[model samples]
Target: MIVIFQYLSIILLIFLPMPHYLRESYLASSMLYSLVCSNSMKSLIQYYYDQ
Candidate 1:
């Protein structure tokens, strides 16, 4: 989807000049945080629907 592509592009831009290890760590943490945020948003929408 567009959102995923945007996320990847942003990551690529940020890491393009960094060392390999730093890039890997940045990507790993960004992915984890995005996953958590997406899940939280999903739960919030579900809660609203259940109300």
Candidate 2:
């Protein structure tokens, strides 16, 4: 699911038109979002396994 979202976002980034600074910011935010999502998912999986 996360992979799919990343792919879609990348495609959007390529196709959408915006200022260069805005594009950079969007890329940064998406990277951060994915990092947070991955960390939370890892913790959730570990929690279930530890139960």
Candidate 3:
């Protein structure tokens, strides 16, 4: 799943002619999104495991 996101970002970086600052913002936002997603997923899994 993480590999898919990595490949998507790499493809976007290569094909999209975004400016340097835009690229940085995109990367930062994506990283934050992935972090939140993973954290929530972990908590959900833990909840189920505890049940």
Model 2 lDDT tens row, 1-51: 879989998999999998999999999999999999989999999999999
Q: Estimate each model's TM-score.
A: 0.70, 0.85, 0.79
Query: What's the lDDT for candidate 3?
Result: 0.88
Q: What stretches of model 3 exceed 4 Å from their correct place?
A: 1-6
For all candidates in order, the CA lDDT equals: 0.79, 0.94, 0.88
Q: Encode model 3's per-residue lDDT on 18-45: one tens digit a residue.
A: 9999999888888888889889999999
Q: What is the lDDT of residue 5 in candidate 2?
A: 82
* lDDT of each residue in 1-51, candidate 1, tens digit only: 646875786778675798879877877877777788889989999999999
Q: Candidate 2 or 3, higher TM-score? A: 2
The CA root-mean-square deviation of candidate 2, after full C-alpha superposition on the true structure, stands at 1.1
* Clashing residue pairs found in predicted model 3: none
Clashes of each: 0, 0, 0
Clash count (model 3, backbone only):
0
**Could you tell which candidate, 1 or 2, scores higher by TM-score?**
2
Q: Candidate 1, 14: how far from true, in Å?
A: 5.9
